[model samples]
Each structure stands twice: as structure tokens, then as C-alpha cells.
Target chain A: MEFLNASVIPYFNYWIYVVLMMIGLHAMITKNNLIKKLIGMSIFQTAIILFYVSIGVKTGSTIPILEHHHDEGHAETAHAVAESGDHHAEETDHEKSDHGNNEHAIEADHGIDPDHFANPLPHVLMLTAIVVGVSTLGVALAISQSIYKDFGSLEENEILAKIKQGGPGVDV
Target chain B: MIVPFDIIILIFLVITALISLRVRDLLGATMILGVYSFLICLLWAEMGAVDVAFTEAAVGAGVSTVFMIATIYHTRRHSSD
Candidate 1:
């Protein structure tokens, strides 16, 4: 009960992914059809992708994209910085104002809080993985079709049985 | 982000995976696997991975299903498992 409340309830996302991965593994191992194995492989890859994406989730955070200051624009910010430098040239108390500017810069650095946005690194990585999984699935299915043409069946046991008979590859 | 919604989708995801793997017809299994991909893609979008979700929707569900179906067209339809 303690473990359930502490671990299972809070991290149910991970537990579900674990179960999904096991289902894929069982299908890959016990299923006799080549297409079924390929399906299992797809499921397995998806589970891992889901796991990574979930890890990057931050509660109460927005999407990773930062809001653009489109209205003000880059040129406006640059203009402001240039105006501040002009004040340094003519100001009688430049030293005092420079000390205040340093404090403002420190505050600006502190404004970059990570909790406001979701983690994007895992998502980018998983995008590549999703592409790779589809390509691998396509290649494996092509191979399965080729094997079916050569052996006349897609069942692994049947193919093995035919191979044991001194083979279709040998005579046919 | 909503707790109940996540739970519902996850339950559906597991159900889809099992159905896809256990179905005898390779074509039906392929379709169910597409559903599996669609659900996971939804999960990603909800989790704020919009780009990943878009790619998964296009590649995993759309293109891969077409590739599988095209192969099945030339090969045997029923898988003897």
C-alpha cells in the first residue's frame, strides 16, 4: 500500500509504458507471423518514444516554444541598448548609473526560469527515432515479402520446416 | 495534462496494441496498429511535443500503414499463427 501510494500512483505513466513494452516483447517472441513480429517491433519503438517524451514532461509547464517579442522586434531592443550607451557619454554621474545598470542586467539573467517551458530535447530526439522506426518497419516488411516469395509461406515454423527438408533454396 | 484524459488514452493504447497483435488477419492488424500510432501521437501532442506528434501522424500512421498494405497486396493476406 505504501509503495502503491508513493510510487505507483504518482508515476503511473511510466508503469503503463512498461506494460506496453512487455506486450510488444511477448508479441515479437511468441507470435509466429512475420508481419506480427514487425507490428511488435513497431509497438516496442513507440513505447520507448512515449517513455522518453513522458520523462520530459514538467507539470504546469507550457510547450517548449518561447513567445516571440514580435511587436517590439530585434531592432527596437538594439536601439534601446544604443541609447543607453549615449547616456554614458554625456552623463555627469555615469559611474552611479553604471552600477544601477549592472543590477538590472543581473535581474535579467535571473528572469530565465526553466520551469515555464517543457523540455524539448527528448522530443527532438524522438522525432528522429520515429522516422527510423518507420524506415526499419518498411525494410523488414520488404524482406518478409521476399522471404514469402522464396519459401511460399510467411510462417517461421513452416519456413524452418522447409529448410530442414534440404530446402527450397537448395532445389527450388 | 488532464488526469482522466491521460488515463483514458493510455487504456485505449494498451487495448489497441493487444488487438493489433492478436488479430489473425494481417490487414486488420495493420489497421489496428495504425490506431495504436494515432493514440500515441495524441499522447505526444497532449504532452507538448507537437513536432513529434506531427511526424508520428505522418510517418507512423499514414506512410507506414500504406507501405504495409502495399506489401500485403502482393503477399498472403492471412497470417497462420
Candidate 2:
């Protein structure tokens, strides 16, 4: 069918991400062990990070750093051309060149396509998310350890049973 | 082009995820989860997310697995559910 055609190849990476995400979600929902649930959560977080990083990819593009030498060369050439021109013809040519240079300056200022660099925004944000995930995992593990000390088991059912029976130190 | 490599890595990822979930022993599952993290880290590096790949390697594969192992040391490894 149309969905099986060649056009779908470009988006195959997204399909893979979705599939991985769903697998992690299923594990998180159905898994009974606390550690298994944490593993599923980690898988889910990685999948989302993959999705964000994929969005910033551009074929044949380099990193997001300005090529100062290239820009300097272009500036010298533009200046040279501006200096060696007749008055009337120079006016028209200068106007066109000025417009082009202004557009390029704006693009460079915004880091939109400075020397074909990839977007750096997602990389920054995902860095924060990764740290947050680690901290959350640490806190959850600490709580799980406490649960084990108090209830003597990691299984959800056993923990629930202990709570239902009004075991000592089971106020929460 | 790059699609073939992506597909192969994705297949491995899916396999590791399923295995991690299917394993009965919590310790075994933790090890498999470590493998899953490693594979995804490679995939991220391949996709040009070097920063993310580095973090996943350190946090997901290294620290998290160690934390799980330590927790297992404190508690039982078998799952009754």
C-alpha cells in the first residue's frame, strides 16, 4: 500500500522511536517489580531523548560553530566590490548586496544556519533532562531500599499485604 | 543509506527490551536493562547526539545498574509477581 512505499523510509527512525517508547510503556504498566519499573522508566526516557536529538539532525551538516574565516573572506570581497564601482551602477549593486548581507547577519545572529551548523537547543535541554532523570532514579531507589527494610520484600503484592495487616511502622 | 544501520540497532534495542522484561530474576533483568541502555547509547551516538550518548552511558548503564545491584543486595532478587 501507500504506507509501504519508499516515501516512508525517511520517517523510519520516528517509527522505531515510537515502537521503543510503547515497549517501555508496556513494561512500566504491567511490571510488578519496582526495579523492573525503574528500568522501564529509563528506557522510556532514553527513547524520548533519541526523539529530540533526531529532530536536530540535518544531512551533510556540521556542528553549530561559526566559521569566522569564511565570514571574513566574504566581508573582504564585498568591500572590494563596493570600492571599485561607478556611482549609478554602484548604487543598485550596493543595495542588493546590502540586503543579502543583512539577511546573512540576521541568520548568524540567531544561529539559524551559521556555516550549516546543527541546532544546539535540543542538546542543551536534553542535558538537563538527563540529570533530572538520574536524580529521580536515585531518590526512587532510596525509597525502594527503605521499603525493603520496612516490609522485607520488593514485591508490590507483599508490600500491600503487610500494609493491609497493619504491620508495625506501616503508617504510610 | 543510514537507515539500514538504524534498523539493525533498533532491532537489537527491541530484543534487549523484551528480554529485560521477560526475565524472571530481577538481577538478570537489571543486567539486560544495562545492555539495553548500552545499545541505545550507541544509537544516540550514531544519530549525532554525542552529549546524550555520554550521559546515557554514565547514568543509565553505569550508575543505574550499580544502584539496582546494590538494592538487590539489600533485598531479595526473586519476583513473585
Candidate 3:
């Protein structure tokens, strides 16, 4: 079927990703509050994540888990075997039934059903981004908290006011 | 055959973005921003980017909006006095 064909152009996703990236950048630059800035940062980072994941996606792809189910009637297993087109599937299926704990070598190595192979790089990048985003959030929140403590308010204007006033005991 | 839904979704996404920028009330503007994300998510799904839609729906609509509102609550709710 043409629906399953991989020839369809991917245009809308690219536009959405670009728009979202711009929106996040606008928010980060325009917003004044520290927390809002962090939110903007998260939005910016998440936009890139969306972009990566979208670019990596292929139609009819499934979760990259190697289903260890050894039941002979499993359609997913049959599909995987049929798609992989190698004796490795039979080996996996046969080995999985007799020695359930021996799937590490088979599952980890190769023959991952070409039609269903997902680009895992995006997922890996997103995992890194999640960590980086949280770290940034933590630092921003700490700075906001410190600014609040020093100026008695969190507003950027309030902080600026204290700085402009040359108030004692308040460090800019 | 190409679906006309793409044009419709793109138009809606642009409209929400414009509305988000034009709105006066900060609260309303933030709400429109959420709608903007939703529309963009739809656009991603249309382009066969389900993973992108998933991230946008979760982070943009869900987390980003919450943080925006929370920041608003902590700061001034109204625009410049």
C-alpha cells in the first residue's frame, strides 16, 4: 500500500519544529522573570528534542524492545522473523524457548527487522537533553531564589531597583 | 493523494501564534500559547512525526504552560504598570 510506502514527504513536521524553536527563542529573550526564562529555556530545549525525534521517525516503527516472548503463536515474533529474513530469527525463537536466559547475545547483536528499525539516536539525545534541562532549571531556580532573598522580591524590576538605588547589603 | 488537512492545520497554527502575540491579558496570552503548541503538535502529527507530537504535547502544552503560569503567579500578573 502507498500508505505504508516510505516515499511520503516530511514537510509539515519541519515547519512545526522551526516555528516552535522560534517561539521558544522569542520567549527566552522577551520574558523578564527568572523562572519564565527557565521555562523558555525548557521550551527551547524541548523544541529541539521534538525536532530530533520527528526527524528520526519512520513509518510503521515500533518500540525497539526485543520481545522475549517465545510462544509459537505470537504474531509479533512471526512478523519479526519474516521481516528480518534470516536464520537468526529461528535461532532466537528456538533458543528463547529452550534457554530463556540466552537472549542477550541474539537480541543485542543484529537482524533488527529492517522495516521496523527505528533511529535510536534521537531518543539518546533527548535523554541527554532531559538531564541538561533539569540542570539548567535547577540553576535558574537557585538564582531566582537568591535574588528573591537579596531583594525581597523576584521581579526583575525590583532587583534592578535595588541595584539602581545602591542599596546596602544587596549585591547586584 | 495529498490531504487538504495540512493547509487547515497550518492556518490554525499561524492564527494561534498571532493571537498569542496580540492578546493583551497575560493570562489569555499564555492560554493562547498553549493552543499554539497544540496546533503545532497537530502539524507534526500530520507530517508523520508522532514522536515530535508526543514531546510537544507533553512538554509544550503540559510542562511549559504550567511553568509559565507558575512564574506569572510568582511575579506580577499584569503587564507593565
> Which candidate achieves the best DockQ against the true structure?
1
Tens-place lDDT per residue, model 1, A34-76, is: 8889999999989999998887777776566645533345323
Ranked candidates (DockQ, high to low) = 1, 2, 3
Candidate lDDT values, in order = 0.79, 0.71, 0.57
**Of 1 and 3, which scores higher on lDDT?**
1
Better of 1 and 2 by TM-score: 1
TM-score for candidate 1, residues paired by index: 0.81
Query: For candidate 3, what's the RMSD?
Result: 9.0
Using alpha carbons, what is the TM-score of model 2? 0.76
Model 2 misplaced regions, further than 4 Å:
A6-8, A62-116, A169-172
Candidate 3 per-residue C-alpha lDDT over A7-51 given as tens digits, one digit per residue, 9 for 90 to 100: 333455456657756876876677665554554565566567666
For the record, the alpha-carbon RMSD of candidate 2 to the native fold, in angstroms, is 8.9
- Predicted candidate 2 versus true structure: per-residue lDDT over A1-172, tens digit per residue: 5875655567766777788789889878887788777777877877787787777655654443334544445433223223223222423434534123222342424344432433445665787888888788888888999988988887787788989889886575
**Clashing residue pairs for model 2:** none
Question: Once superposed on the true structure, which residue ranges of model 1 sit more than 4 Å away at CA?
Answer: A1-3, A70-112, A168-172
